[model samples]
Target: MLSNTIFNTIQKISFIKRTKFYNFCKEIIFPFIVTNISKLFKDDIDEKLIVMGAFGGGAFVDNSKYLFEFLNERSDYKLVWIAKLNHVAEVIRKKGYKVVSTYSLKAIKLLRSAKFIFMTHGHMDLLPIRFSPKTTKILTFHGTPIKRVDFNIKEAFMYNGWGDYFRLKLKNNQYIDYVLTHSGNKIEHDVLSKQLLISSKKILPLGYPRNDILLCKEKEFTEELKKKYNISEGIERIILYAPTFRSNLIVKFEISKQELNRLNKLLNELNSLFLIKGHMVSEKIDFNDQKSIKLLDKSADIQELLIISDLLITDYSSVQLDFLLTLKPVILFPYDYDEYYRTKGLNYDLEEIAGGPIVYTTEDLIDTIRNIDNIDYKFKEKRIMLRERFNKYVDDKSTERVLDFFNIKYRA
Candidate 1:
């Protein structure tokens, strides 16, 4: 695997350049087109709900796809999705929805005229999009309890580079409205915004419609996943090792050539196979020839993986919060806990928020695994507790709650 520091540096350069280029187009071409679209599409503004899945990857993919399925038969909202990615746009188009390629000044105008807009989620990149303050925006917050970055008097005085991002982008909570809840964490509703300095009345504790797939344990789906990996019918357990990206990037991930060697050896010895999955930003790992330990190459479908997965070992990927509905065992591997807490920050401390086991070292991880050797006994109680707490309703009809929140009546 390539070093994360080098990868992140390259990505940051590419990100900055991309942001500048897009913002320039937004400022120049978008206004002219949006103005015209408003006149041309005045007749259609109330006919369709234009949703910008501008985040344009797995996160938005999960939300948009599920919403599309729910609104498939409804004629109230035409339900147009704007996509920037070719592959994902193709996926959405395949589902019979018209996709505006993305960022055409004309398209922005059309989006502005829509009756409502779903801001897929929190994205700082949107700081540039020109739309009227009157546009109805729904910010679906996947994680609402995100810990705020508190600047110290001393740190602010130093004028550090690390403080600059928080200084400019965050400093306030007035950017978004209407917190769409996935886990239904009521604690977020009571907490007041620091920047807004007033209570937000738009926090809706509705369940995410996308995660409905996780609740389904169909024999056909489970069998297909096992067959895909050539895992025999029921020989061993399926453990998912999904880790989020480390903001610090370097210290959070200490790749010991020795540890990789040890992990390869341990995989050969272990009974339950571990599928190593990197976060969206994490550098991909390539294993020479290992069956028990494998790395995900380019499979976009995570819902299927979640279905076959029996025990999940994740680190703050929000998938931990997503998978909480199933009551699966999640193990947090915060090797860079101090660095992450100091820098990236968490909405809630893992000790309080994470409803599962946490391991800080290799030996401790192994010991935790042994202690929970019996799959049925290990997570039975915790899973049930998580299920009732996180999920208000775990059924095919979670779309109902989402529609109730949006006031979009479900037709089918």
Candidate 2:
């Protein structure tokens, strides 16, 4: 705990990242150590072996999780999940899946010998490791980009200086062999290629594995979710409010008890349950004993929640694009639009991409929810158009397509 506190304190010092000593350690010393350590292992790539991880192996969620599930069901391939946290490993173990600790000797051996290593965030998902040149590293990015990412964002380049940026770029190019996207559109391809520092050819528009569940109607999963959340059968609707992470770590919402009570009353009157799922990095909003309002687990698989939701309320999140596939009602609540735009930046203006009502205040948000039926009807065409622009594939066969692309045969 003391060591962790010290590390956290050092990380909070902004100038440390810009120091010459830090750059030497991060860009030079770290890679050198990883490379030398990796050399100790043989480059024996197992064609049937695939290792996967996400969110630095702290949680099992995202495109990698779905892909892991698909492969786990098959008999031909040897699948393993690399978990950095013991609890995460235990959870995967409870599901009767093979999971190894990221720092374990078994994990290092698996990573070095695996033919394919799949990740959602980055290579760090299986941190402090290096892969064989014969191994293929595939990045199934967490979401469709609505905000700037990686080196594409100005802050990333300016924060660490050009030398550090180039070093990071070189590392990314060396590590990631391929990246997956939801669509084949030129703009999408270009954005990913630029942000990820990889060639356009390496960006495969094979669709996202997580979106597969969203396209298909999973009644069993819905029932499972209902039981897990203890949601009653009498509930008419489930409205999910998921907001993207803010750089400042502030939640720009009315979280006062009075306001929460009012929102809860509105949800109760509509026979609906309002759920708030904040981004992993975002500040948590206190629901404050409101019976109709619930705060979802931060590490929950949101794709499953999206499956059971009647409506989605979000602000500047790529989740809006995923929810559009459901052809359901969405309410955009960008209360801090100007401030967010200035600090974090967005790829496209909200008005240009929003397929539903855009409300700015708590009162407006409540009013919009009250009249959601009409709003849903009004945005039908717009939603379809936006969905097509964002997601090219609308079927539940993305996992199959991914397997086919990789030529991984599964028994029927």
All models: lDDT? 0.57, 0.79
lDDT tens per residue, model 2, 253-350: 55566777888899989999998786764456666778888877777678988988999999889899889889999999988888778767777778
Residue 203 of model 2: what lDDT? Answer: 86
User: Which candidate should be chosen as best, given lDDT against the real structure?
Assistant: 2
Each prediction's TM-score against the native?
A: 0.74, 0.88
Q: Which residue runs of candidate 2 sit more than 4 Å off their true CA positions?
A: 1-31, 150-170, 248-253, 281-285
lDDT by residue (tens digit), candidate 1, 1-412? 1322332354457556345455444333433344344444443445356554535333335555567656766655667666544555567777777666454544555565666666554422132243444555666544433444333212222433333433322222344555565545455455424322324566666766677777776789778777886666644677777776443342123446566566556655665676766555545555665556666644345666777777777666667767777766777777767866776666666766565778888666655655655533655576677666666666756667777766777665
lDDT of model 2, residue 244: 86
